[model samples]
Target: MRMKRYPFSNKALKAMIAATVAFTPIAAFGGGFHADQVEAAEQNLNFTDLESLVAYLQTVRKHLTDEDIQVLNEAQEKADRISAEDYVDRILKAPVSEEGRALFVATIDFITEVNLLEAKKEDIEAFAKEQSPNVEAVFESEGTSITMDQYLTYVANVEQKFLDIIQLTEIEDLSEEKHAIALTRALLSAKDPSENAVITKTILRNINQEEAPGAIKELVQKIDPNLSAAKVVVKALKKANEKPEEPTPPGNGGGGTPGPTPGDTTPTDDGVEVTPVVEANGNEVIGTIPDALIDEIVAVVTPEKDEVVINLPKVEVGQTVSLLIPAELIDKLKAKAPDADITVQGDGVSYEIEVEDVDTAALAKKLGVPVSELSLKVSVNPVPSARALEVTKAVQAKGAKVLSQIVDFSVEAVGGDKSVILRNVGNEYVKRGFGLNANVNTNRATGVRVNDDNTFSAVPTRFVTEDDKQKAVVKSLRSSVYTVIEGNVTFPDVDKGNNWAENYIESLASKYIISGKTNGKYGPDEYMTRAQFAVLLTRALGLPGADYDGRFKDVKGDEWFNVEGALMAAVKNGVVAGKKNGTFAPNDRITRAEATAMIGRALNLSFVDFDKEKFNKNKKITDFKDAKKVGASTREDVLRAYQAGIVAGTTKGNFEPTAFTKRDQMARILAEFLIKADLMSELK
Candidate 1:
């Protein structure tokens, strides 16, 4: 009986030849695979049965060199792993044309090259030197001179292009023209709209002159007709289509004339003056605000005080406009609003403001209240200038005391609805011993966004000192009225002097890092389970775990800790590991030594040399009498935790390595670790 034959396509054969030639040297030295063995295997490519191919490859192994034998063995192993049907199906489904293969290969090659570059980033100079030849070849193919800086720029462009390609590939049945339009949309959404405009024009120039405008309009309408990016793309494409092409310069061949070089002040065919595009940090740079539009906006600075009022023209909801303020004016603005995101581009300072009406429903949902309960109010004076006494009176009327000078400023969210950081948001209440006083706790000072109903949502706040002035920093997801307020937060069982961990418990609870047991009672003396400790540690580090898949056999997917992703997060971060039996022992009581080991791992502490003789001579573990009882696997970790001031011995002078850790003790140890490791600032 005759067997069916599966022949390789021309493109597949070419790929095989390229791979063989490229890896021949490595195969020779590594005793892997040689060219002759691959050539022999190629002759037998007609074998439809995977087993028959494996048998044939094995038969040729005895007649080849060591490298050739290794190659034959690898081929045989691959053939053995696949079924005959799958092998035939793969060959049938393979790309037939060189163009199809090239597209697939280019996508894969770009991804591989990017990964390699990222892996070699620590030794980038050496990596770049090795890759220079390949980079040079790319530029040489385009008839361009290459420099090290230009090479870097080319790499960045390739990476960005790869990312753009990946995004476009996600849409089904994406056309070539649609891909070009999508690229324009992405560029227009960048921080510098002017730079994006030039790129959008370039994209438009590449498309068919007859089809470009219609394709852009159709794609933009499908995406968002009102989007600022879409608007910019429409305007840019129109201008690009209207511009007449420049005459071809005299050259060897009639290839179209090249575009103007950087810093070239050549006028276009339409007699409009061309602004030279500056090259900055390997990017084509353009001014954030155009020169012609500067006179449309007005900025008035008052002489009596450091205040600058900006009067902006009417901009649409999603539209972004840049203003170029003078240095002295920027200085005054910064003095009044220190948290404003000010970008200094060349001789001008530009800042973007996105205007949008407040979403009352979303705000109410975020505040955990009904939409009907939201009191939506819009101030007639957008930028209010009020006296201190008047501000104090207003805050008192709202039933909240103000701790800092009334900071009035507008916040602009970068990258569309992203969180904005407000630096130096409030006065230095910490420096004034606010928390040390019996009546108040300065640690409770936090920034809050004032709602129209007089209620406020607490912002994630932190404290830092700049030029000897203590400042409160806050981060908010929306633009609104914000101020600093201090108030006491206490739990029934975790009051002052109740336990050694009272302060730690209250502090962490106030920050929402940990919570009390049922009925608001904190079980300070209760033994903490391994799962409980894992949850607390994950929360303290602010590690994201919502998407984590549980891996432990004993840890069920439906368990509270696993559902919350705490246990999975702990395992993923290498802070905790399962037992040798593959069980997480989630419900088991966690020992003191075990807790310290997890803390040490979280801090990324290095292992100490654990020589018994050296330890006896150096008396490193003598601080705790029962240090010898520490498990060998956990000894180095415990020692690391002790040295880092994250743990301490009991008052009885014993380490108690096998003893179970209690809630209060864990709280104290975790708090100390956070403080010592300077990780407290990461808490929200």
Candidate 2:
């Protein structure tokens, strides 16, 4: 059962599935019946021949169900019995000679071939050989030889034929599988599980009456364990009286057990929690569904705290939304989710949810965690004269190639160089960022930016270049995650250069290292905390296979102190083979000297070529003296990783060995470790 590989290939995994599937039977009837029998019954429903029937049935599998399946079995049994009975009854009634039975089989063969035909025939007799009857014998005996048409037509319509086949079987007839299948289909088509239990019982009754076939009864109970002899009788009565109808209950309908009497409750606008009592087995537990399936469903819907929520209108049938949430929320969200009609993401947090109504936003907000964060942007028709200079500078500073244009506006007041001031103000607005806005008014200098309830903000910067905001709407679509992540390293089409790595490293503050200052922006040059250094070192050494479960008292899921422990684990794993303090100084701005020492430690070098005083401690890592020392001292380790093509300098092929490593630098360093170790290589 165990494979030698750590991660089995797809082909090997499929072989495993196949090997296991041979022994996994369909346990619909408490393992009383084989899967092939049910499958055969399912197969017989659409057969012209065995091959075509199997092929076609597979395609229509989504449409096939327990009721149709049951009916097929019933009809098949009835057909076989009637066929035998008609054959015997006609022979007994007529007292035909031996030659007549052979002739009758030939006629039946002719009819079967004609039915398999691709062409229409006006007279079946044209294709069939008419057997000239025993004229003299016919006069003496009261027997008749019928045509193929008459035989086929009569066989299809007769009732008594159904009884004969039931008598000929040795093994118990598994009409139960068909019954289970058909009724399950009915519930499925109705798109409700509320009626699933009832339908299951009704199927049991139609097949078994006395002592009730244990197999059928077991299947019925498997679906609705509360179903018993009394309940089965009541359901049989209901089935006999009522025509089959699709289940369409309002509160979690179709598949669950049908509610008492008029089986629907109306939805309300008011916020009253509607609790449902789903019964499984004979017990009335607080909630419904088996433990295994419930856990599986919950595992799919747990949600996390930090993900974007898009404001949307309500939902309607056939509408779907791709809502993204954090990985942590999968369980809690699934617990409150509707059981019927909605199809959500398999990942649970970022799932594509199908809503019956467009007003689903209201429901989602109520059922899911509340919105936690918001981002804002402002737009204006044109940059005011005072803001133009700042706008220009921002435009220049943008690391991408951009088409540029400017407008000069005369400002009458404020400074001697009024126009210049207006331009500078516009530049400042660009430094902030903007979009085109139709409602921006040039006449007014002051406008409200933030709304009172913290509901909305106006992005008030603009360009006269974008005279119409609609014109700014681009036709291009954003690329997928695979593409965007690729751009984090690749030189962009705009020739922004490999400088993207710097921006990527800079952006890592949010996901890679630590929290920012109160100003809501990372102080990129500020000294990293000791805890931050541990994290950086961990990243530099390449995050190794972590057995650390965040189980320690100081390393609970949200604890900030986990960083040091995580690094310590990395150290133990030979990922970071260094240590400074028995306790790490979690809040110090590390100097260039310290960074080199740490990198050296990670390389597991017994000695550095020069003394500690060889390179200046205060200089940035970008300094050449430090770079030379690092490039020369740990040459072998650096060469090992570098020649393996895992290590490289930031710019101009120079390893800025003396520069103070920033947050981004830490990530690059760690990425090299990962690449060299042949671990988490995708990070490269």
**CA lDDT scores, all candidates in order:** 0.41, 0.27
Per candidate, the number of residue pairs that clash is 1, 82
TM-score of each: 0.35, 0.25
lDDT of 2 by residue, 610-667 (tens): 2333333443433333355664444444444433334455566566545566654554
Residue 191 of model 2 has an lDDT of: 13
Candidate 1, residues 41-102, lDDT tens digits: the string is 01112333223322332343334445533433443343234332211222223322333233
Lowest summed lDDT window (length 10), candidate 1: 32-41
* lDDT for residue 369 in candidate 1, whole number 0-100: 58
- For residue 156, model 1's alpha carbon misses the true position, in angstroms, by 52
